[model samples]
Target: MNIAIMGAGLSGLACAITLEKAGIRPAIFEKRSQVGDRFVNGEALLSIFTHPDRDNIATFSDQYGIYLSPTSHIQRMELFSKNKKAVIEGHLGFSNIRGREQDSFEAQLERQTKSTIKFHSEETYEQLLSDYTHVVLAAGDGAYSKSMKNFREDFTVSIKGVTISGKFDRYTVMSWLDYDLAPFGYGFLIPYSEKEANLSIAIPDIPKNAHVHISDLWDVFYQKVRSQLVQNLPITDQFQITQYPIGICNSPRIGNTYFVGNCYGSMMPFMGFGQYAAILSGVYAAYDLCGMGNYEELMKPLRQSYENSLVLRKAMEQLSNEGLDRIIHSLQGDWADKLFQSHRINPLKIASYLLRPYIKLKNE
Candidate 1:
């Protein structure tokens, strides 16, 4: 069966790689001139794959023939509320993958596909669907949202960050819940190396009572976190910032078209980490096409996890500053470990917890 994949991002590349491994070469189309250029947050460290049950990131890379390098292993995060702070430690880990560079992980993986990418191809989604036997929509930002009926848009996430030249604590990732940095989102620091790190904030685009743009959000982030965290650290001239929309889709695939990555809401709702989901979606798609596995069956666990993340996100939205402070402080030691590491927690229970506030309002 002939297949066509759109976009050269991680998901698309992963899909192509898997198909090539299965001896079915798929045609790849990328809008960008070079691989990884379109991905706005490619440099940020991803941690979910570091779990013991999961393949060690290095091993996974070796097994899949993708290039991924270890930067720093961070197992703890320092969370700050307006008044209180908490330190939660667990299996949080990260890797360094530079975007657009030749040595970057995505670039290396793209090279392995050995397929000619129709760069700057102007074929519309409908046109591609008509021409290819099967089309994989790896292009994110609601690429096939209108075509699919069950697609529900959640919100736009604005990612703003600057590289700084200074020593960053490689042992921990930092986050703050102050309203100033992000009225509806949070600020973070992910160290790329000991001397250089990406200081970024992911906030909702349309925040209540705020007329905010990407530039304005960066200014607020600088004043609230960067100014304090990197006191004498010089902000490098090279920096990147962008925004993308994310949502959940009940029907990711219909007929011959498959939706992957952000278009299918593979990102974790809590912090927007999606590389794992994106890659997995693509790999499973290849397997299904080759009649080796069921894509939906493979995605069941991730779908449930996404639902759980949404439940937590809703619960976080209702918290007052003081409540947030209390919750942060309460999460410590074994409690924090269990919360972060335990995947056995029933998502249904969390969903019920999120509904309690709304249920009470309906009764009143």
Candidate 2:
């Protein structure tokens, strides 16, 4: 059976290897002349990995010269509204290195893959429809998957985001909390270097042309930086400013063509923990196409493991919002602080307010 995998990013390459392990040699086709350019992997955020094997894999920086930090330890985060005026802490999260580091991984994986990787300079969506029996579209961003109109009707997935990264101690490790400083989205202050940090803002599924003004978000950040945090990086230091749009794909996971990876729907909504999810999806796609009866049996534990991951994701989203609300409420004074502290710590209390599910489960 001839299998053609599309996009050599994390997802496509992973699928190729899985297929090779199954005694099938798949061909990888990348629209770019090179495999790793469109995809980036330096200081890429991996705030969202719960997989058991997550710690086992080496980063691209391990193979290539790019700077990639391994999973050292999970750090607790602190949220402060305008410097030390109000501070909140005791939250845990993680981030993986992305950007150029990711490109290096793809390059290395291409060499490690059992199948042939075809970097077609003139490759377009039209040719992909013509040449393969089974084509797994792992193409990310607007270029590839947007061409498939049917995909839109199936899922409600969109993201509006902003990110900026600069010299902050040459990619130092630190705790960054959502300043809760933005109106439309979340604000991020990434400590990249000792003398510089990137301030980021992200909104999920906001209109492309919304007239929402965010001068206030920066105003808060400006004042905060002028205070104690200023010692780390002043507000006037050179900074990287960017807009990042993020969303989850509401589409069904399996289909006729097997839309996988970012193409299937962002493996992660702006959290940027896409690499591993892409690799995992590729593993699932290979099992589907391989058609070995035992593959499904083999996949049971894998799916179960990832399903828990999905559960954790949903839970975290709920927790984040609740935590944000509690922080906002607590900033007023000690009475509110004591009341909001528990909510800040465990934001998923909404599970009790989940209407029928909780009631039914409770009754059960």
Best by lDDT: 1
**Which candidate has the highest TM-score of all?**
1
Question: How many residue pairs clash in model 2?
Answer: 24
Off by over 4 Å in 2: 38-73, 81-94, 101-108, 142-147, 152-180, 189-199, 205-209, 213-228, 231-256, 269-273, 292-364
lDDT of 2 by residue, 1-364 (tens): 5667778877787778778777888877877777666423233333323232323244333422223233233332334432332433222233343333433556656766867667764566567657767777777642344555434321122222223333443333332334254432454544433444445444333343254445445555545544534443334323232333223333423344766666754444323446655665667778778774342353444334333333433333343545655655465455433433343332222322343241322113
- Candidate 2, run of 10 with poorest lDDT: 153-162
**What is the total number of backbone clashes in candidate 1?**
0
- TM-score of each candidate structure, all chains considered together: 0.85, 0.60
**Cα lDDT for residue 267, candidate 2:** 42
CA lDDT scores, all candidates in order: 0.69, 0.47
| Model 1 vs. true fold: TM | 0.85
